[model samples]
Target: MIPAGSGGRNRPIEHASFYAALPLIDDFERLSDTANFTALPEDWLIGVSDIEGSTAEIAKGRYKAVNMVGAAVISAQMNAMDGQPFPFVFGGDGATFAIWPEQARAAADAMRAVQRWALDEYGITLRAALVPVRDIRAAGLRIAVARYRVSDGVDYAMFHGGGASWAEQALKDGIYGFDPAPSGVRPDLTGLSCRWAPQSARNDMILSLVVVPVPGASARLYAQVAAEIVTLAQTLDRGGHPVPRDGPAMQWPPEGVALEARAQRRSGTLLRQRAGILFQTFMAWLLTRTGWTVGGFDARRYNRAVAGNSDFRKWDDGLKMTLDCDNETSKRIEALLAHYHDRGILRYGLHRQDSAIMTCIVPSIMRNDHIHFVDGAAGGYTAAATAMKVQG
Candidate 1:
């Protein structure tokens, strides 16, 4: 007899099966209104990719490069699936995704390729690891999933299980695969970009935060604190939103040409690829400036949507947010969060910065579903991770 969580053609270990099991959320505007997520399939696996010494790299003012490698993980995995939808979240210095066992090998291979590419092309060491859901469950942890439609074509994954957090701990403890990929393998980071300049905070400061439930802490209390943080973020500048509504003005070839060159280094001849990108960027910039009709689509509106709909906050095993707030508001929020920390109910890290940076995956300029990953301009998630380590 086939074992539980087993798959046949109808139950192929793909995202569709998992999504099919979920009740779809048609309301895109009310993301926080969703109910608790359901348990994930035991036959699936969790894939993670993180940069070693990412904090140090960020300190060296290579935060953009760090963000680029992080996004590369998701990009590679998406390519591995050949347009299949899956549950994934992009951390500033890494990324985590749930994949079916059937596609685990492809996912693993893609991660390894990115690892190699990061080391060779950017001198960054990337750690790619995979843990089975069964193992996570055996460790007394669980992973639950929910789908939140962020826009007409974009849906974000909301993970409820602490399994993801436990898996990350396992990887850090050297429990799973942490070795380098074979030589000559390169990650396909198609459409990944760090083109925009750092977004100046309309508020006096932008806050980056990471919050985890402390041992013996009430889950309910932890969730309440998390919700409070989101509520505070909703009262920020720029339409009371965490992300900016206006897109960064794009120069002819964009500001970070070196980053663009590194991203497309694997595409073809470096010079030719760079030139092609420059030409495409010029055309896009011209269209947005002149309000020229491109296939009957509004170029200017698309640019704003890319910024306004970015993935700036996430809740995996822990709660993370990048909030744009004034100094007074930031202090008040910190004091509120500190009360929970003082009570030993949660472990959190908060960093203040003057601006936030974004890395994007624009599969198509016309697509409203493009994803932008945001982080504080200085250290962002790396700083939060550092503070948490100190607390531990």
Candidate 2:
């Protein structure tokens, strides 16, 4: 959910202009229809953050930390906007956000903050980069975008074309790195958390996948693959959505986790980190139990909102999903994907794990909404991405 304005009148002037300048689609159903998306403005800026060596980190049993840091990049940028509207998509290992030219500085600062946080707190390198939209176009690539209305006060951006991918590659190639914030300059990681236990595989396995159309692939073919994924999700996963939405409920004296390492704030010291965890644990109990009203906070309603805002399957330049299905179903899906891959229609990566992990951001859940992001617990998007690279 977008935060409320940083201030009534002091909110950045570019906020309104940037959102007003774009074309938005209110219908989520139409997102699958390729005709609905439009080319992004040439004057905008594309910013991205991806954790280097994410697969290794996941292998080290730090998947939760990886997921948390990845989501933190998006959360940090959203907070920087101070309630302004922008287009962003969460990747399993990082996030990509687009901003108006006027907001580039703020966006850059936010990225730097997240980069510093990732390195200092998680001991992972978060590489962030920003490139001009025009430069991308000059390289013969485009950023196509559309907005999907999920629920009241919740909207997500869908991206098409290969521009975002190209930009990410540039970052990886050391062509677009941003100057990070000063040492100890932490990003506002206030809303990040991982409160739920890992979700067990429903039938046999949870498949972490990334499917990208081959270079020069026709839009019609890509759309066909996209539609097929939706059909498979419905036909296989008991129609419960490819991404499940089971999180901690609003119970009193909420269950506390033995380890809070994955959900600590990055702005504080060791003592403060422990204190922050205790405070959040206590707050979870107090807020959900007593139903205490503070700053328009309502734990019960927030819990409901959390369940509603699950982002299990996301679309950016390609499709990324954490699907819950048995072995047979997964094989069938893979066969279809392989059929397409062999035809040079698309490239894909598939990895299986026994559970799914979630990271969340609940900023005033009563006001806006709470969103939970899920990925396969072991390997997940990172491993899937690795497999996809090898396939390519």
Candidate 2, residues 262-325, lDDT tens digits: the string is 3454444566766666677678667767778677767666765665567777678888877788
Cα error, candidate 2, residue 191 (Å)? 1.2
Q: What ranges in model 1 sit over 4 Å off?
A: 1-15, 24-35, 238-242
> Pick by TM-score: which candidate is best?
1
Query: Would you list the C-alpha lDDT of every candidate in the order shown?
Result: 0.76, 0.74
lDDT value for candidate 1?
0.76
lDDT of 2 at 159: 83
TM-score of 2: 0.87
